[model samples]
Target chain A: MGQEMSKIEEAKNLTQNQILEELEEQLRVEEIEEQPDTIKTEEMVINFGPQHPSAHGVFRALFHVNGEIVTKIEPMIGYLHRCFEKIAENRTYAQFVPFTDRMDYVSSMHNNWAYVLTVEKLAGIQVPERAEYIRVIVGELQRIASHLLFLSTAGLEAGAVTPLQYYFDERERILNLFEKVCGARLTYNYMKIGGVRADLPDGWLEETLSFVNRLKKTIVDYDRLLLGNYIFKKRMKGAGKISAETALAQGLTGPPLRSTGVAYDVRKSDPYSVYPRMDFEMVVRFQGDNYDRVVIRSEEIKQSLRIIEQAIEQIPDGPILAPGLPKDIRPPVGEAFGHIESSRGDLGYFIVSDGSLKPYRLKIQGPSFANLQGFPAMAEGSYFADVVLTLGTLDPVFGEVDR
Target chain B: MLTSGQLLEFANTNGIPIWVLDASIALLLSLAVFAICGLGVIVLVYMERKVAADFQLRWGPMHVGWRGTLQLIADAIKLISKEDIFPKNADPWIFRLAPTVMFLAAFVGLMVIPIGPKLVVQDLNIGLIYALAIPSIGVAGIIMAGFGSYNKYAMLGSMRSAAQMVSYEVPRALSIIGVVMIAGSAKLSAIVNAQSVWYVFLQPIGFVVFLVASLAEINRVPFDLPETESELVNGYHTEYSGMRFMFFLFAEYIAMMAASALTVVLFLGGWHGPGPAYLAPLWFLIKVFAVIYVMMWVRWTLPRFRIDQVMDLGWKVLLPLALLNILITGIIMLL
Candidate 1:
């Protein structure tokens, strides 16, 4: 082994002890050679991709893998760089909802609502009671759809093809509902500035209720298929574990954070959009591993159902959209960062208005971005397969992560 | 020319043309077995999807012909027309031959397998040994594809597979030995005949050990560490594209089916049915599909094991259990 090491070192033009030092020097040089001369690691970097299938979009993970477990990851951005924030800045408050559809295309309706809710909060706009209830129902349903995707994609990347279609079979129904409500399927820009774009389609409530009813049985089936699976347990349990403190320090929110035993849900901790009035338990689990992340999502889907059920019952007989909010009205020159508990994590919008028709600047605080910060920490010293599972459990949508 | 042992004189009395069987008849028989095995792979894949749907609470592949029964046929067509790309620097000969060798090795193993009463391709007296031996030929295909592709990841993958398959074979064969001893025949039909009661009930530990090791042998998860994507990037066939990739996939699914059938034959009883002997192969088919379904379920349900853990499972858990089964079986046979 020593002879082999020496031979490798000789090939690299270095001694055994000099190898680490030379590597560090190379890293420093690579960092300094950047366009702006920024310091960075140059440690045998491999570009995970701009068009790679596994990167899950035009996402690139610049990895410094010492063997299998990545030692450093400088995630390069600006691939699916659609300039969404810039587009949002120029569009009217109502027009901006469509652009929000571009944010996370998997659960576009939830992104639409998150943006609209932020704008509504800024303008002191009170949506009709029915709209609030309708919003929660749609949002929760979108949460299930989003997490289902996370679960399936995670499974697919991990070599589990059956679950992707199994989850997609149910997902197709939800997309059908979205298509019925709005003319679009993937990007439902249905949530307007003040409320929803229109009232729920006739029998939409009944259809949603039926879906909710079936989803209960479906969750049970998911548990039977996956929860008690010995392989699933072995793969996920104690893999990619993050302490509650580590999660909080990294600004991780939503299920990933909650899975670490921190019950800080935006719905429960800082309620918005009639969530305070809605009755639902804040689903949580203690072990901050990939298994816990998965289970938390499972529980959250059930909780989302509970909330949706209540929202359907409590929906008032009134207009879905408020009548008075102007289509182009802009807020005064001030900055407001509105954060919401999106299905992935804490999705937020930071708006800087110049007291004009359009805001001067807008920033999207995609939860997936912050959630990715926990990845390197979780991945270090883990097996190659576990890295895939960990990333899957983190549920980082490259759209949000790169945005 | 018949070598008879105690209670084996029936073979000489039957005067079967055990040697030099007609080439055309043998070819026809081999072709028939091949067809059955191919059909079994297709049906198993579809049934696996359906079972997965049942587990995941949804409908699966319902849009194709007649509740998606022809989905596999459609998939086969799609695979046929696909362009098979050879990598720029890949070894042309080996790359082209890899999938064929893999499929051939697995397919040939089917010949020795006893399907039903008097319905075997060639019931070699060394049928059990032949059944175990043919699959190890697949290791050459894996290594050839891995090295021939000249992809670093594929090389690593094939290397890991070479090590894993060889290591796991020890326990896999040992586990089956318990049943072979009890049956007292290397002939597959005789083994099936001996299973008046399934070895699964009598040799439960052996059954479990064999099942685990067989999964490792087929490179299914939690033993799918060789193809760990996050590590070696699609393992051995990373450079293989289009139809070549499909061929690799075909081999994998076929191997999954074949391994499951072998497990059924060895432990679950090959063709002993509740009804007539002619229905035995159907029973065997059902058992094999059930095993395949469980394999798929496991693939979706669990994560891949680390190479070290996989090695440990093969040596530490399975090997010991297999040895224990042998020891106990020996003691019981002595008593």
Candidate 2:
């Protein structure tokens, strides 16, 4: 019985090795078979996305994976091809604000303002002083909200869900204010061609004051939860270090550009909408890394809060919307590109009016779309984990990228 | 001879009723602590949410109880009612046993915690040591769940957690040595009593080391490598579901509570009186919450570390520093 058991054990060992050898041979044969097809093709082709989770959206990065490295990334878009620009061409200026919501849904207000600001410039309409101030406040608040969402989701991709919940909770408060102001929460069509849709509510000032005051403690909490964390530092620091030269070449702006040590904020550089009087500094970071991106967001939130506080203090007692304008808005035949510092980057809207109520053409220069262009360039030699971190720091809004 | 028989008969009759009553009370109080653990787990989760919300510049649970106080109630309801699922290929007993093992570990750790003066469930002389030993048992549960799942990611996560816990254990234990040497006792009450000025000011280095190590051991933030979403997904508990999943979650929060309580006992002076005896536990809880808040901040602010870096920091930096802290404490004590 003992001799038979020993023989059976030996046979089992032999069978295990045989199975291992067979599996190895199968893998080698599969590799051998798969390589020739790609090698024979003079044009080496690889599809990087569409189905890939890290493409930021339905955007595809068709590329050649040389070993573990990405050789090239060809961005294949139109998966979310609603042709928002074309849709805007047929709609009146007032009607187009809703469509603007589709472009960068994270910061829909920025898009709305950009479109309206362009039309307001073409029509040569002067917005009320209080309305302009309120617009700045709302726009700045939305920018903070959008950036916080970016921070949260980016952190989520890095396996940090607590911060995501924290940020969304804060974002919900801003959304509540939006709902109170415009009667719409996520997609607020508050901005009209000439001015805002409605006047500020009765307790709007008091509510805004309380929100501003409470903002600091929450910021401290976020700091405790994330900023001061060692792991967060390890993951973020030196992870995606882009230089100012590369960023400039890529036409990067807003947080990404600022992260590369540039101090160019649209509010400071161009001073559109009553930003000239606003007391806010351009938040900049020097490392040009993921850490810098996070710091830039943090600093920007502070500046945004500052702007909101100032707006509340200086808001003149006047009509919320500019009066004495034609109900059916029309601007003369002209074209203008209005740019705003959206949460992701610089959001631009080029409007071509044909002296009609509707535009002849509307071209949206989505910052997230442009910002996503450089992802493959950055992701070449990095690990898969870094790819997630890098993509997070870029803060891509699929709505903007796809639109 | 008649008098001796009468005395023996009288003593036996009285002793039985007193012993029975004491036994019943002890059992009832143990039951109460067990009940409190259930409530404590729910509150800890809600508190984390509220704290996180406050940090992000928002109100957390306004829709639930007064300011969303009842949010945990809703969450508990959701978790309890959810379907408990086990994979077809999983080891049936281990899969069922893993969460229970984790829960049991947490519950045992709570036995050593002295919430207030004489309010302990068990005032064992080895209470502090018992608290320290219980968390390591959860590692086994993690490994069991990982192995039983038949998922590569879960297995990898389990391996990662084992390494992380082992590495973190050194600094965590060594940091405690400073307080241990100063108190001259392993008893938690003695440790708290020794800290009249609070160990925070005296052994600030030890405090910092303990905080970092505890955070790592609890698997928060930069140390949360085992379950990194971009890497290992949901870590060791990937296949867990329903009440089992909740059990794992409860264990994590309980671990958090345990770590916080340890911090209070060692550095912040646990249940020491700034107020009346009844209010002292509240103060202890507040200190623990503060530590938890700091943990949250560290999580949000910092990025995660690679496994190698985590181990290197633990073995090379924290271990040596913690040892030095203990040595210096010893020298100071001798003088």
Candidate 3:
């Protein structure tokens, strides 16, 4: 039996150089056979990004521009890839929760929550009601922060500066609130396997409620300053319009999908945590254009504020962590998928545990990676400026996409 | 009066020969114009940053001098010392010559504006028209710079510049006809004097068309498609750096100053406020700064338009409104 198992392993094993050589040979054959330079006479291939000001991250796009219009665009990713999936295979289940923090650093609470949610599902562990409520509060706040960032940077890409600064001020307040709660502003590794790291300190919830009340009124300032301005409307409306069919076909979710008049929010469709107990509406816009994308996000900030308020009131006094779980986190052989409505879109974490301390395999389906599939279509016939507008509206966080 | 003729006469009486006195007066006026152009830009740069900070809620340039008043001067020194680059196969002569044209276009346009009753420079016969024509020279330099840069972004930017400048010039030139008709001459000083109630009240429609077209003429935001930051990078000046870049910047601010001055002269009644006759130019300066402030306000508030949208605003909206103003002015004159 030992000899047979060794023979099977040896048959499957391939040297690193052998694998690289195979890829090199395929690339060489495809490069010649495909005639990559056939249309060099009429079209100009512009290499955009990876290092561009508004590519948002290290996402490169190869565009064939005819005059100011983009005739074709092929997005080339992987410049920021560090293989978060492969890293999960080596790290223990409980130890790898912090890795999700760096995956989408913009809203680290969502990343933290998603990984823990999956682990709890896979191990059949239960989280207390107080922990769920805390998760909901921080998750909603993180969504607000992420959307505010999206709106501000989108405004900047269209050549407006004041709105960006004004929005950053609001985000600073949220960051301060997060700091007071967890002693960490960004990439808060506060979520654990079955509960939160700690309970809320004194007066933090009241401060949060006051901030939400203030933001509810102040959010209109963005519209008065940027969205309602005629020039902004002209520049962004109908600039990179995507139909609902095209967006759904590309497996788009989050604001990009919601902007197309779909009400498919993960928090609603597949209710999780304390979300089902909360009272808030999912924001949606009819037109799937650049304008709708921004409008949806700006309106969604109000909804997040609503959710945060409800979570503060309904949170029950109970144990923060569940009991009767091994510290080592060795789950019996099983697979499970956990998803949450992340800021960018539907973020799902899949893990396969083979009755070991570490996971056998892990996969993350990031919304940004899926949302980026719709980019070439949006940018195909638009003006050069509209390309940046479209990318800004999609709000792809490269941290999640390349992870 | 401090007119050029009086200055020459004063020089002649002060023991200078007639020929020498005439040349001296001309040289002094030229020197004064250059000085105002240079110094005014420094102040404008500082004011714009300070004002932009106020609008955006940020502290802008608080380190160099008191309130960073000398920030631009330090910047000037930095720019002068940096390596002046030229792209491979770029036309050296045109690349070197382009900024001079951009600078002189605004500089020479300053010759005809009457800053005060007696502080007129050349006071040409067709002063308003000459001012209109002079800045068109910047178009040529822009195109040359774009062609000479050997970069595709520069080429597209210059192409957009050529199209935008040519299209906007029609409505801009046409709008001035209403003011000329009211003043009964194309002379800018005569236009200023004709406005008993600051023609903005009499010809409000003309003033509106003029403000819109003039904003487009100077490439202000919403009309700044040629230099659309998100689109074409830096537009026509994408490849420039060091002092050559500074010259382009200088040209932009000077054009702004000259345009705002012309707006004051045409509609605000140049130097006509209640004040000492010699100190009246201060009123002109105030009104011009007011117009510049409004321009900055519009710049900060509005996002940039696409090239097609800019072209549409020029041809479809501004041109017809300009012609309508002229038609109404003619009817009023006939009645």
| lDDT leader | 3
**In terms of docking quality, how is candidate 2 classified?**
acceptable
What local distance difference test score does each model get?
0.80, 0.79, 0.88
What is the TM-score (0 to 1) of candidate 1?
A: 0.82
Query: Model 1, which residues run further than 4 Å from truth?
Result: A1-54, A62-72, A155-166, B1-78, B115-125, B189-198, B225-233, B242-250, B253-261, B268-308
Which ten-residue region of model 3 chain B has the weakest summed lDDT? Answer: B1-10
Estimate, for each residue in B1-335, the C-alpha lDDT of model 1 and write its tens digit.
Answer: 22335224553567645343345557877788777777777887788778777766678889889989999889878877877767789899998898888888877877877778777777899898898889878988999999898776687688889989999999989998999899999898899889999989989998898888888888887778667775566789888776777777777777787788788888888888788766887898788878887888776566566666778888898899899999999999999
If ranked by DockQ, best first, what sequence of candidates would result?
Answer: 3, 1, 2
Q: For candidate 1 chain A, which ten residues in a row score worst on lDDT?
A: A37-46
- Alpha-carbon RMSD of each model: 9.8, 9.6, 13.1
Best by TM-score: 3
DockQ (model 3, Cα) = 0.45
DockQ for every model comes to: 0.33, 0.30, 0.45
lDDT string for model 3 (B1-335, tens) is 35658877777788778888768768998899999999989989998998899898888999998978889999999999999988888999998888899889988899999998857888888999999999888888899889898877788888888898899899888987988998899888888888888889877887887888888878887677767666567788888999999999999999999999999999999989996787789999999999999999888777888888888988999899989999999998999
